[model samples]
Target: MCERNHPMKCFLATLLVAICGLFLHPATAAEDPAALLRAADRWRVSDDSLQVETRVQVLGRDGAVEKERLYTVFVQSGHRSLVLMRSPAEAGQRVLMLGDDFWLLMPGSQRPLRITPLQKLLGDASTGDIATLSWAEDYAGTLVGEESCEGQPCWHLQLRATRAGVSYQRIELWLGKARREPLRAELYVQSDKLAKQARFVLDRPEAPTTVAEMVLRDELGTHKETRVRYLSRTPKRVPEAWMNPMFLARNPPLE
Candidate 1:
């Protein structure tokens, strides 16, 4: 696995720039794409551990809800996460991601199954969607130009994968000019086909920087959509053993 997490030193400096508007000014901000990506990474939740409830909704061509599921998510500092399905049809199904690796544990499975991040989770959401705030580590970003997103001035960032085994080979991101929050993103395959378009909804009153919901719309067909919402967020300590696939197979039920 590549270096998937930035050091705490960068986190402090980025937080300073994010909170004080020190680097918000276009002129003062670093023009390098990599630096801009680091700045963007600061907008994510960086607590030591985070627990949240996620709800995913799938909409059909006519804008009717086709399916919905709730999930409980646990995230650690080192890009490690566990997602447990809460709905009946998919209950006891869990996905664990450690660094760049992923595993899927289903009910009655003898062992945990390894999976890739590019696999579709639900609707327009991919397995990579669970960890949406990893661009700083996975991609090399370049500032393409200035654009308007959601009627607000924003920076258009073009990102290419730095290492292998990433969900999308390339991505285009838009962030608010003043706040540096992600406004929109376009995911693309290696063939340059637009796979999905995502909009970040940062409306969490408790955690202003954390994106509360992500709206993903399919680029093909009738433009089906999926919305993943973060219902609650709390900081806690997660044990390392819990992230192990062997431990996952042993522990069937999620508390």
Candidate 2:
């Protein structure tokens, strides 16, 4: 009777071990790829008025301090977006965004000048249809593996642009384990050179979810650092009429 019960006990133990193994697996292993893609798409700022205050620091060749400049960014989805310099030279100079067009309003100039596509290509901003939210539309994202960023465990992902006109050819993103928020990102050019890297340190997980603090460092030619801080975010829809280029240049969003 004891020998017969020994085999039954071993079988029960094996079953329990298998059940434990199932629970120990990574949560993302069972996650649907399509669902994850959709979730990433849904992660956007749906606010009527969104503001970001930032301090940009230009670094010397030795990675030491250089100069600091302050700027304010106001974004109203589909309607208008404005970035104004607050301190140092070019104070009060603003970049206005209306619909698909972009214009720069100088501190002294009364008229807003349109930003050419070639000039946009040279800028740090991501190129292509700005309104789209899907990662697949702008980049081809693939799961790299589990990694660590700033001592926290994260999922590493590699995103490459599908089209040639895009700014960066590839981007390595470090996503938070629980929140799925992007913690860090590294941009790379077609020459296999590292262009820029950004680390998001402080995050506000409240409604109209905001990234409170971020440090962006350019690594390619000249080293430049930008620190961004979110001031406020309100859930409000923007008017469609405000998205036109003519309206953007005529009535600047700065005031």
For each candidate, give its TM-score against the true structure.
0.81, 0.62
Q: What local distance difference test score does each model get?
A: 0.79, 0.56
The whole-model C-alpha lDDT of candidate 2 against the native structure comes to: 0.56
Model 1 has a clash total of 0
Stretches of candidate 1 above 4 Å error? 1-32, 204-209
Shift in Å, residue 218, candidate 2: 2.0
- When superposed on Cα atoms, how far off is each prediction in RMSD? 11.4, 6.9
Best-fitting candidate, measured by lDDT?
Answer: 1
Model 1 TM-score, 2 decimals: 0.81
> Deviation in angstroms for 227 in model 2?
2.1
lDDT of 2 at 237: 36
Worst lDDT window (10 residues) for model 1? Answer: 22-31
Model 2: pairs clashing at backbone N, Cα or C within 3 Å: 48-236
Local error of candidate 1 at residue 70 (angstroms):
0.8
